[model samples]
Target: MSFEDKESPIEVDVQSLDEPIDIKAEKKLIHKFDYRLVPFFCVSYFFSSLDRSNIGNAKVAGMATDLNMTDAQFSNIASVLYATYIPFMVPGVWFMRRFARPKYYLGTMIIAWSLVTIFTIFVKSYGAMIVVRLLIGLCEGSYLSCMSVIATDYYFPHELARRSAYYFVASSFSGSFGGLIATGITAIKSGKLESWKYLYLIEGLLSLAAGIWVFIFFPDSPHVLTVTETEKKIQADRDRRKAVYMGDTKFSKPELWSALDWRLAVSIVIQFCQDICLYGFSTFLPVILKSGLGFNKMEAQYLTVPIYFLAGGLYLVQAEISDRLRKRGPVLMFGTSIAIIGYIILLAVKSSAVKYFACYLICFTLYLGTGLNEIWLASNTAPAFKRGTSISLNLSLGNVAGAVSPQVYRDAPDYTLGHAFTLGCLVVCLFAVALQSWGYKQKNKLHQEILESGVDNRTKSRKHGDDDPSFKFLT
Candidate 1:
């Protein structure tokens, strides 16, 4: 049935042509897509990451001193954000999906978070601070998963990794600008408002603008976008490349049970491990540089600028290579290994230069594995509902580590303990990546076998894509 019909074509079979896949046409379509969707989302994401990580910069600017926050109290405030972040994730994604267009829900939530960022200026007491952090996390809990789902909806499986990388790298670029801005703002000692408050005010206004733009301009979906007849044909061809539902479709018991298996379990562990490091670095890097490595706050902020630049550059390279090679596993393995080396060097070194270099290595792939694995799971899972849930599960459970990360790094200025904990998590995550990669390899192998037999389980289940005998895992 057509989408116009009452019966949604969400689960309806979309058949591919007998003719060869049109590689050139698809590339052109994807390139055209790059200009339309990537820029605004990148700008939005830049603000999201800035608001979240700028706290580290704020800490150095004396937010802690002004509020009389001890190490433990600051840690609690950091972890409290994750309290709502975890529980609301699945619900948040569900809510976003339920909306007819993203601007209503996603845009509203972005604006909401930006308002919360602005509210930070009013946080005089510890209790008020806690409330603000929690509110921010609640508003942002669904963003990553929601964005991932939107990406999968628009792009082919192979294209998603690079597209996602584009979204993520902007966060890295924000670090460069966020640091410089923070450095400048905190230097303004004459103002009635503190430097951190200025950071919030500026970044929040930028985010509000971006959110409003999204609500006003973003299409409901790629299917609704105005395109030529040739573009429509190519899009239809794109639809046949995957089995995910495009409209409202309920998940069956079998589909749900199949999805909530060892893969999900592994993904949860991987995310848990991943976030401990991701947030650990984002939360503590500025303080770590100033306190532990003997740099002043301004010098530390400048030092951080280079790391973000390197991180964005490396991520683009990593994303390009992974997309071109059509393998997510190697990237995960390589990123983890580089991070491990960075951590080990941090522990081993006493020189400021050596320690700084080590941080660049860790920063290079810090956000990469998390982003890559999200795509890996989304592409390999069948049906739209399953893919959405998988993304939510990864994001929700993984973020719990964010709560834990602050405590481990609680002994900041001398955060050897935090570095150790993050190193341990990265190591465990490496193993998870290996096992997950092996699972994909095995699944692809079985898919080939079943295709030759012509008695595939996919045929029996009447499912396609990851469920199809011909489908192969990206890794």
Candidate 2:
């Protein structure tokens, strides 16, 4: 029989093995797996990333010259964008929890940012650019958090890391594609029309189109999709099984607040530090290659593509491994440590070829952190309302480092201080990962004690008499 026709496998009584089963429910639950969810999330993330990182490509092309700004001033403009992001993330996420569907929340932000990005092309001065960038950040701040919450709602905890990797790989590819597209557009210049301006306009328009598509085609949740009634029944059953496995039908406010404890705080801190390293590389790597390594602008842009592609591939591989292992701390630690090593090579190597190779290492290490960190936060949080808020807080707080990092790169020919700062940030991330790992172990031990004592698992409670003893961790 198909998954939809199979009875639900969840035994309601934790202690009863002799009771007759509800085979129909089991089938419904198995059949409810909506495979379309992944593609929707991937597409949403792709446009979100394209709009944000297109600025990097624009900066290299002619954004600085057109706006008549100094390097410091340009860096400050970039910083301002992220500044708004820090304060707005919590509020944005809270709004998503209280008022709007994820589809609506995420779609609106995409449309708004796209419009703002398009307006960027028409700005005549540095001040206007800064204002627009900040506004864009305010609009775009909630998309990542919303996506994280949505991912958890659909996938089991064990499956989240790999799913997150798919989302982030879209983001990584957008970064590389943005560069290539920017390079191509900038290569063609008309009288009075700057390539950077055209670059922003084109990307912004694409984002607008994507937003419209998502608004129409995306389902708010698996239960509301266009699937058959049989499929919907299956999906509901699966959710029930997941609820039992987690020990709760749905998250309560108190549970959410409790989940946002010290562990959540530490994850945010690690994300913040890691962002310092990541944004620094993403935003300024092209500039460094062109100016420091003596490559032309186009060559530098093209060269960065391979690094990003490899990084995206590595994110999926690492996330899969982490999921298989059912652990978050070790995965994060390993990823961060690799980032540190990459930065060391960048700092120590004098040869041009060696430095280029180090760029690949940096890409691998930095992007690897995305999947581990996103899954880590999602796994630890309860589903629904609190999950959305927690994700927003973590992402918004972590991204504040994005604002700080651009300022680290002074106008000097070599961005030595920026590289040094990134290295230091990676070290802090290493420590944070260790702390989180320890905390997870403690939480797991306590949970085991509770199980042994006949207390319900903090997640979903098993039916009173079911004897299945398997305790799954959200990796």
Candidate 3:
């Protein structure tokens, strides 16, 4: 059942085949130092996140009263943005794969969304606010999916989880930063514009600046970078090695359709349920602090700062552990289970101090699990065009729950129904994680069986060539 016993189609010299791949050497020589890539990705994500969640800050700074809207109406505006996002998710990735580089696509989307965000400052009515938000969602949908695809292009499967974690952590900081920025802007009482309007304008301008920087510096893929010839060859070697290991290099219609099998379908469903908990908590945290804990605006915003920073920090830690272990299922399950417990406490506890502490626990648990989700999906997918498309599909479909989560807040200044709904969804997330873990274990067992038999087994009869081994699960 060992890897040594497998009869692979790859015509490597027996000696070389027996030697383990030197991952460290590859990382040092091939990847070289690309400081710009991570910064560009992180900064772009920070702004994207800031723009998306500024509405939460706006709500507390008098946006609701100015626009003559109720809490439910504000929630509806949030819901409408997500509703527009669902249809654009898959198509945006498809477009990225076809017409443009991912960096360009992602940067352009950022600029567009930021512009839409800035336009929100001019809106005078609920209808106008809804229109601006819808545009913002439509423009912003491409950034996360495309950024994930770009990360996989730069890092190997084993390296993906930590990088994914970093990206999510950046996003979490953006959420935290948005609140802090709102607090600072709200403190300026003598400004010509209202605090809420200034929040949108300032965040939007920051996004515009970040978008420009990304467009200038970010490389499309490893192959397109301005590295030395030796580095280029190493990068190509790494890409080919990944393709050979994964068993495919291009997207095929049949393979794409097959990848959406029952297992992936269930993962998407689990993601949907998880997002309800995630978006609900993140989008409404400030509101919860103000109303539930009876904190003033500045106090509530400052309290939100540590919660998001801790959440981002925990995500990065979890990602590093997951990548080091080269396992996805266990990490994901553990993170989700932690989130489930946190939510349960939030539902059952009565003390305000206990509730605030539980909020931190909830943020940590949800975000840590989220980082694992990105890593798991990105690692399992085949490389090349299919990887981008498939990851996008998973994220986009999973996020459809965003459209439904805000509705759970209606008929509630208490938001009790929303919390109960999230708890139920977390239970479903637990089941889904268990199912995915079982599937991964089953696949690994079958591949081990084939290795033991010394037969060139193709479980689903995928293409085998003279330079490739049968695909193996990372676990």
Query: Which candidate achieves the best TM-score against the true structure?
Result: 1
lDDT of 3 by residue, 1-475 (tens): 0000011112223244334545575566534434647778778878877787777788888899899998889988988887677778777766776677666778788889888888888899999999988898899876787777667666766777776676678889988898888788868788778889999988888889888877777776666663776566656565555545444445567656656666668768777887887788888888888887678988777788888998898888877888778777777777777777777777788777888888876765566665577557666655354455667788888888777888886644557888888889888888887888788667667656766787755656454321123455554
Each candidate: how many clashes?
0, 27, 0
Off by over 4 Å in 1: 1-22, 243-248, 456-465
CA shift at 288, candidate 1, in angstroms?
A: 0.3
What ordering of candidates by lDDT runs from best to worst? 1, 3, 2
Report the C-alpha lDDT of model 1 over 1-475, residue by residue, as the tens digit.
1111011112222344455666788778878777778886788888878888888888888889989989889888878888877888887777777644676767887899999998889889889989999898888888777777777667767777788888788988888888898789878887778777888888888898888988787766666663888788877766654433332345445555556778888888888887888888887888889988999989978788989888888888898898889888888889889999999999988898899889999975677877788877876776667667777887888888989999998886779999999999899999998999899899888877887887655444444535666556777
Model 1 error, position 183 (Å): 0.6
Between prediction 2 and prediction 3, which has the larger TM-score? 3
| RMSD of each candidate relative to the true structure | 3.6, 5.4, 4.8
**Which one wins on lDDT?**
1
Task: Write candidate 2's Cα lDDT for 1-475 as tens digits.
Answer: 0001111112245234333345675434423443567777787788877777666688788788778888899788778888776787766666665667767777788888889988887798988988898898888776777677666666666667787888788888887888788778768767566888888888889888888877777767666652676556556655555554343324355545655678679988888888887788887877888776677878877777888888899888888888788777787787777777877887887777887887887775676675578667666554344445567778887898888999898745567888889999889888888888787666556656766887754564323211123332343
TM-score of each: 0.93, 0.87, 0.91
lDDT of each: 0.78, 0.71, 0.72
Q: How accurate is candidate 3 locally (lDDT)?
A: 0.72
